[model samples]
Target chain A: MKILVPVKQVPDTATQVKIGADPKGIDTAGITWIVSPYDEYALEEALRIKEKQGQGEVVAVTVGPERAKEALRSCLAMGADRALHLSDPAWENADSLTVARALAAVIKQEAPPLVLFGRQAIDDDMGAMPAQVADLLGWPCASWIMEETISEDGKSVRAGRQVEGALEIFTIPLPCVLSAQKGLNEPRYPTLKGIMGAKKKEIKDVKAADLGLAADGAQLLVVALEALPPRPPGRIIPGEPAEAVKELVRSLREDAKAI
Target chain B: MQIELSEEQQMIQALAREFAEKEVKPVAALLDAEARFPHETVKRMGELGLMGIAVPEAYGGSGADTVAYVLALEEIAKACASHAVIMSVNNSLYCDPVLKYGTDEQRKKFLAPFASGQQIGCFALTEPQAGSDATNQHTLAVRDGDGYVLNGRKVFVTNGREAAVALVFAQTDPAKAHRGISAFLIERGTPGFLVPKVEDKLGIRASDTAEFVFEECRVRAANRLGEEGMGFKIAMGTLDGGRIGIAAQALGIAAGAFDLSVAYAKERKSFGVPIAQHQMVQWMLADMATAIEAARLLIWRAAALKDAGRPFGPEASMAKLFASEMAMKATTDAIQVHGGYGYIKEYQVERYFRDAKITQIYEGTSQIQKLIIARHVLGAR
Candidate 1:
């Protein structure tokens, strides 16, 4: 049995993002890149599946430039059997759809029994890649999966997903796509042995053009970018309770116009 | 020469930093106050392959080099000096000498479990009268059929009460003095072997420092590490490597204090503005930072030399001496930077101050390190 997990490298959520000089993207200077937190859930789930089965290979795949290899190495350190890095200059500024297409091309070659992904990359918050990839592959997909179990024969999977204030469960066939949610499972830290072993593991690189991608493959484009405005200072009503209440109501109704 | 960390070293350092911050930091103060050993976190460290960073995978270790070990130790010490010393004694003091001198069978029995973190081990060398004058041994190991009957006392044994195995040094032939000493692998719970006391320490209170007494305890000849007369040489060589670990621990303590001082200086107000605006405070911070960086460079040099399989004794001694003294000074100034608050337990810089003093005294004192360095220099001349 083989499992394939698609991971992305994004700037750490705690980083203070600065607008790039070109006004097109976040500044890369001083930004530390980490494996998307949601994607960690996806990888963890994949590893758990492999462990439960007693034997199987978990392949971690990614689409990015050279710096992106760090993310792949991290996955390897986390006990991924191997890594497939799709690298090319054409991948720069690629949209979710373009990423899906490249991933679909690789999935066709690998033909893994199952595919996993994070519900969304925190960087873009564009929860579209998993569904788009599933569509391109013509495979069934269950997003925001919180629980999963595979049948004995490995022919089907049952997954429980978190909907708005409700639980939605689905039974999907093998070779389907699944997106991991936050509560899926806790990821393990890479052990010292694993980190050393990762250096010796094989990381096979593929070209974007070979995956049938082009510079014009990106369908989404950002025309402008701006930082959110600073929050307004607070106002304290200094008076007796009744008078303070009256003053607060008046400020809310007239000055701030919040009411 | 280039002084950059390899990617693997950087990765381990990052992992250690994250572990220290997330798991160790929250409980450090509570553990110190209670003097409770962090068994859970130490177990987790074993799972993360930190317990045996430099040992080979075949030997149930992480197979990392010494540089990586020092890097990881520094991060752990930054959070809790107790955890750092516990890790240091296991890696450098116990497993290292066993790996170097023990036979293959001995390695499997004595080194594997400890290196894998499945079990703990300790080194017992200092007796009541044998500290700086390590050559004087009051412990006796008389030859008996197929084994030796040991009778003696050892003081200041780190990880003593909790360890499953202890590498004990006893005089096999007292007539030969220091040359007569031999190292033996003694298991806990052996007849007549007792941990009489667990000391109440000022700093690193979370770690156990015990005293051991053996009365007619018998250890098999097969358990002896190296030849009978090779004990002193093994002990000295082990301390040379152990000093590097202490240097890294001292560096971490200084860095931890320096971090708190910087944050306190920025927010703390004196007269009209933040104390950071004062020239004297700025100079103190500058000095602390400079000393820390210098000590870090020295530690790295020693660690790198060891990894390269070169003679690093003087370098290790130099690093330990400078870094230990630097930590004492830095922690003292850190308290000064914090004023009265630093003197209080809640500020935690006082704990760092207490921890710093031990580094100057253990694994060969600052004075002893100077002597070793001088001997090397004169010998080379």
Candidate 2:
């Protein structure tokens, strides 16, 4: 059995982002890139499945520029058997549908028994790639998956997904797609041995053209980016406790009109 | 003249930083307050391959170079100096010499488990009377049949009570003095071998420093490291590398204290403004930053030299001397920056100050390091 995990490299959420001069992208200076948190869940689930099976391969696939290899290397360090990096200058502005199409092309070639993705990339939060990839592959997909287990014969997968404060369980046949949610599983830090071994592991880079991807066209385009509004200054309520409470209530009810 | 870290080195640094911040930092205060050894996190460190960072992979180590080891050590020290010393002692003091001098069988039996962190190991060279004068070993190992009968006491043995194995130095021929010393691989369960006391230390309180008494303790001849007269040479050579580890630890302590001081300066308001606005505070911060950078360069130079299989003894000593003194000063200034809060345990700068003192004393004292460096400079033979 083979499990494929699609991962993305994004600026760490803790990073202080600055809008680039173009206003459609973020400035890359001094920003540390890490594997998207949700995608870590996907990779962890895939690794767990491979371990449970006792015999299988976990292949990490990423579509981006050269720096994306760092994310792939991280997955490899976390015990992925190998990696596939779709690298090309043309991929710089690819959209969800185009990325899904490129991933579909590679998935067709590899024909892994299971495909996994994060519910959404934290960077864009579009949450559209997994469904689109599933559509392209004509495979059943279970999104926002919190728990998962595979059958003994590896012919089917049972997954629990987060849905409106409830868990919705789904059983999908072999060769299915799953988008992992936050509560799926805790990801392991790569061991030092694993990190060393990862250096020797194979990472096969495929060009965009090799994956039958075009250079110019993308279905969805990003136009503008803006920072969130700064928080308003806090006001201190001063007086006796009873008087302060009265004044605070008066301000909330009358001046601020929050009440 | 390139001074850039390799990708592997950078990866280990990042991993260690994350581990130190997440695992060690959370429990550091509790461990220090209780003076309790962190068995759980130590085990986790072994599982993470930190226990044997530079030992060969075939010998159950991470197979990293010395540069990687120092990088990781510095990060660990940044969060908790207690954890840092335990890791440093294991990697540099115990595993390094064993790998360098142990026979293949010895490597397989002794080095593998300890380096992999499945078992713990300690170096028992510091005796009650033999602190700075290491050559005056009183422990005797007389030849008896296929092994030797050892009798003496060793003090200030780090990881002593907890370790399963020990690398002990003993005199085989009393007349030869330092040249008479021989190294032995002694197991914990060996008869007449006991860890009689665990010291209450001023700093690095979370680690166990023990005294071992060997009363007719028998050790196998095959367990001997190098040769009978080669022990002093082996010990000195090991200390040369060990100094690098200590330097990194000192560097980390200094860096950690500096970081806290800077943060405190920005947040602490005095005279109606943050203390950072004051020129005096700024001068201290600048001095600390400059000293730390200088010490770091020295450490890196020593580590790179070791990695390149060059002579790094004097450089290691220089780094140790400078970095340890810098740590002491930086930690002291950190306390001053925090005022009364730094003097207390809650802010934790006091702990860093305490930990910094030992760096100037151990792995050959700052005085000893100067002597070594002076000897190298004068080309004494």
Candidate 3:
């Protein structure tokens, strides 16, 4: 069986974000980039699935500019067998669906048994890849997948998904898309040997045009972005216990609208 | 000049950093308070190829360079100095010497296991009477046919208790003074070789600093490392690399403290505002950041020189001296930045302050480093 993982690199969660001068995006200066934390779950699940089967290939694919190659390399370091990077100048302004379409094109060529994705990219919080890619391919997909197992026969998938307050189980057929949720699995750190091996193998690059797709012309344009307004100052109720409690409750309900 | 780490180096550093943050830091205080060795994390480190970062792959090591080793060591040190020193001893003190000076046969035996992380190794050089005056001859190895009978006491030996093998230095010819010293690879469980004591320390309390006593111990002449008088040269060269590890550890300790202070200053309020807004606190934070960067550069230069196979003795000494002193000053001010909270055990800056002192004291004290630097600059012994 061949498993493919689609990954994205985003700013580390620890970054102090500042709105860029253009007001449409955050400042990129001094920001450290990392594999999206949720997507890290996707990589972990793919690697784990490969380990359990004991006989399969794990390929990681990504669609982004040159910097996205680092994310693929990181996946390789984390024990992915191969990396396929989709690069194109037109991809610079492509919308979410365009990116998904390009990935779907690669998916068709590889024709892997399973494709794993993070439920959402932390940067965009779209949570749209599995649905978009699966819709493009006309295959069944389950998003927010928390638990999964491939049958011994390797012809079907037993998956558990996150819901309002409980798990929803589904026995989906073979060759499906699954978006990993937080509890899917714990990710492993890239070992030293794996890192050296990651350096040895070359990442295969592909052009969107070669895939017979127009990468330009985004479907949706991002309007002006706004920074969150500064928080109001804290207030201390200046009274003893009895009056302070009443005043605090009154202020919470009437002035702050918190109650 | 900016030092750029290669991708492999960055990954190794990141792995170590993640390990430190997730595994080492959470248990650091408990381990320190209990004075317990971190067996679980150390074992994981070995498995991750951190224990033998600079050792070659052929000998079961990760086969990276000195720069990579220091980068990993600094990250571990940032979370817990104890873990850092344990890694440092195995890499620099035990595995390094055996790899460089041991024959292939000896390498297979001594270097492979430690570098592979299956076993730990230690250096037995600092005896009760041989602290700064390491030339003092107290340990003896008397030739008994093709083997030798050894007797000595080695103190302040890092990783001494848990190490599977020890590289012991002893006097073979009394008249030759320091030249008489011969190094031997002695495995644990050898009859008459014993760990008589383990010290409870001022800092890095999680690591075991032990005293090994040898009485009527026997070893094959084949176990000897290099020529008999070459022991002094081996020990000095080993310390050169060991000093670099210590410098990185010191830098990490200070960097860790500075991070705490910076985060604390932003949230900790005094005089109706965050302490970070105050001029005095800003000065402290600025100085800490600048000193840490400066210390890191020195350490990088020394590590780079070693990687390039150039002479880095004086440079290593300089790095150790400056970084250790800077750690002291940085940790002190870190505690000062936290004010009353820093004075308590619940806060971490106090621990950093305590841990910083030992860096100045061990792996050749700050004074010793200055002397080496001074001697090198003056072209005098």
lDDT (C-alpha) at residue A211 in model 2: 76
Candidate No. with top DockQ: 1
TM-score of each: 0.96, 0.97, 0.96
Q: Which digits, one per residue and each the tens of the lDDT, describe model 2 over residues B217-249? A: 989899899998888998999999999999999
Clashes of each: 0, 0, 0
Quantify all predictions' global Cα lDDT against the true fold. Answer: 0.93, 0.92, 0.91
Query: Worst lDDT window (10 residues) for model 3 chain B?
Result: B1-10
Model 2 misplacement above 4 A: A235-259
Model 2 chain B weakest 10-residue run by lDDT: B1-10
lDDT string for model 1 (A153-208, tens) is: 99999999999998799999988999999999999899999999998998999887
Interface RMSD of each: 0.4, 0.8, 1.0
Docking class of predicted structure 2: medium
For model 1, how does the per-residue alpha-carbon lDDT over B1-381 read when each residue is reduced to its tens digit? Answer: 788999899899989998998998788888899988889998899889888889888888899999999999999999999899989999999989988999999999998888999888899999999998899988999989999999999999988988899999999999999999999999999998999999999898888999999999999999899999789889999999999999999999999999999999999999989999999999999999999999999999999999999999999999999999999999999999999999999999998998899999999999999999999989952
